[model samples]
Target: MTDLLPLWRDLLLGGFILLAYTTEAMTGFGSIVIALSLGALILPIDDVQTVLVPLNICMTGFLSWRHRNHIDWRLLGRLIMPFMLAGTVLGYWVQPVLGGALLKVGFALLVLWFVLRELRRAARGHVAAPKSGWWSRGIVLGAGVTHGLFASGGPLLVYGLAGLSLDKARFRATLILVWFSLNSLLTLLYLNQGRLQPLAPHVLAYLPLIPLGIVLGERLHHRVDEVTFRLWIYRVLAVSASALLLASLLQLG
Candidate 1:
């Protein structure tokens, strides 16, 4: 098992878990990136992921079940999952060969480009029609690769899915199911590699936060209108991309 963290650090991590999972519960994605980014301050990034990925399974699984009726099964099984899974496998295979900094910078730039374009259009009161064809598929594939690399593929996935112009409920529900599937794969990988053993205590301790986050976030989710929700999604994407870029650049420096 990994060495136990100091009590204060553990408490801080719990706080981060609460905040991050709450966001995921409300938005249907972001728990891993948000928690890992914050938790990395107190723990190694790898350790943070080891703990958070499994914890994400709990959050996503419950949300997926709760919102099961709203999922867009056709969109998920036909388009998103297949491309993303292929990219994820490829990404995992090549992870040892590629430099992490380069991949992160590239992914961040890609997300920022899409997000800024969408935000500008939104500002002009122009809603771009849902994207299709190879271009959208490519985005989802790249998102899978990023997920494999850093468990932070959410922004790109969001970007790709936003084009479909799903209503807030379907959008949130479908995305959470995608996360449920992806994170479960990650958890199984971790288990087979024996990574989860060391992090079991942390995982258990953090598990309670999931339901609390769901309760709070579900209430908030009901209040936001569709337009405001979409706007905030882009805003969150912008923030996530910016943070990823800054972190990658800092690491390079």
Candidate 2:
């Protein structure tokens, strides 16, 4: 594991953290997916995951607390949490055998699929629109597995949440709370496996920047209209997906 403190690396990683969490703070999700895709371009994938997961846990925890009163507990409890937990445990167990290059390709494909789906919906004048009665056990479990394996499960879970038709505030609040719980479980699995300890020093060093990102993200969240927000989010998803795909191809070549 490379030490995270070589000043330039710290600054670069710090910028990604700020950008990722700012998205999270605004949209109630996206931190992990955005961060991992961009950070992996500079740092090793495992190293990026090492520090980012813990930082995400902290960031989502704070967001969850801030929106505690608005959480859609029924949806979270009955539909999302259970399968996500099961998938996380299972994915963690399977992670060691999964090839990094293959995983990146799969992640990029999945993200692009989501982006196209959202764009199609937007073209139909349905931005931020939720589909009715699309919830299922499989989507939840798949989200957990992806989150467990790649730390980029937010897109899957976010799409699922969009279908449920909760108001924007409640939707964001519920997503944050769900992430806080799921990430906590994933973190515990990491600890039990002895993976988190090595990343602590870097996490500590980056702690100061977290609050700044959160504050800026919250402000951005308030300023943006729902339609415009969804547009920018899909655009970002497309860009990040493209970047990750390019990186994987370059590595293969």
Candidate 3:
């Protein structure tokens, strides 16, 4: 029974990885967020993040390379990356000071509001005003902080990006590049802190699922129209935020 227990855990972990990464591959974000949310049911959240963060680089790197031409470098370099990176540094420094439950609950409420508003607009056939000025940048900054704290900042990032009206291809490709850059920085930090050494074996064990997830996601990505693709993004944000809210509330209780 003891031996079988380990096998069952491994299988569950693999299943979670497959499902999470497939979502990311299709949408260009959400793998870590979804994986952490679901995997926490079976594994420690810290362990789940340690394993997923490094592994995400592999998935994002491949998609970035394969769709390099589709990336909107001007938007990424000028707006998203710089603001997000700054926020990440700030978030990392303050993580110990700010409690996890507070941050998670706050973030969940913010995401839920944004996603619900967007979904309602879509349902009414109203076009969303393009995000501009400091508002969009602020959202990107918040996403960076979330990424730094949890390595699952996709919801906020997606919310910010949706304003740009990117096509599905550019949307997926550009977001993948953003994640690749951010995750690389995170991996370096982990290495400096010697946090990844103990987790290396688990990372290797789950590495195979990356390619498989990407393949499945690619096939599904093509079937969805642009409108449906946008809708799916909002739906993912709603689901992720709701889960985060529930988890945080549970912890508080």
Candidate 4:
């Protein structure tokens, strides 16, 4: 019973991770944002990053490699690379320094931003997102840093891509490519600093399920139409955002 109980717990968490991955594979983002905040419900905050740091690496890299044939190399190099590097450095510097409450507030703000942006976009006739330039570049860079500091960086980077009105497959493949580089770099940094401890053992145990989940998700994603999938995306974004806001406020209060 004791052994089975632990297995169940792991499965439960892995299940959550799986569902998050499904959305990412299906529509190409939100898993991280949703997973990061939702992970807090199942694990301690410090431990959340520890577990996710490795999982993100495995998931991001695998998905990217699996779908690499579909990735836009230009988009990745131009938009994702510079910002992720910058964000990682900044995250390392700032993460341990911030007060818990303040950090929670910042996290909540990001969640709110994602929720609002998606809602607004949906309301604005679901038109494509405007092209980003200088400010948006900085936005992506800042988001990259936040991703390093906190795994929830999905809202900033992923939601921004919605403006492009990419079809689900393109969005999924491109995000996997970007996250492969971003999360891999962050994972290495964490490994160097010794934050990669408990994650590996847990990740190894859960590794078998990722491939299964990806295959299943990919099939379903291909089956869905663009409009339906996107509505589902917004639904999740709104739910996660509201959940994040409540969680952060509860923590701060």
TM-score of every model versus the real structure: 0.92, 0.90, 0.95, 0.86
Error of 1 at 160 (Å): 1.2
- Give residue 241's lDDT in candidate 3 (0 to 100): 78
- Quote the lDDT for 235 in model 3: 81
TM-score of 1: 0.92
Candidate 3 per-residue lDDT, tens place, 70-160, comes to: 9999999988999999988887778778737777889889989988898888989988777876888998998899998888778888877
The lDDT per prediction is 0.82, 0.79, 0.86, 0.70
- Candidate 2 lDDT over 1-253, as tens digits, reads 4565677777887888888888888877788777777787778878888788888888888888888999988988887888788877777778888747777788789889989988998899874645444355777788888888877777777666665567667877888887788788777877887888988898898778778888998888788887777777788788778877876776676
How far is 199's C-alpha from truth in model 1 (Å)? Answer: 1.3
Ranking by lDDT: 3, 1, 2, 4
All candidates: CA RMSD in angstroms? Answer: 2.8, 2.9, 1.5, 2.7
Candidate whose lDDT is highest: 3
User: Tens digit of lDDT per residue, candidate 4, span 1-253?
Assistant: 8879767767777877787777766766667666656766656666666666677667778788887778877767787677766876787678778626567667666667766776777778767655567766777787777776776566677655546645567677887766767777777877888877656787677677667767777887888898778777767777667766665666666
Best by TM-score: 3
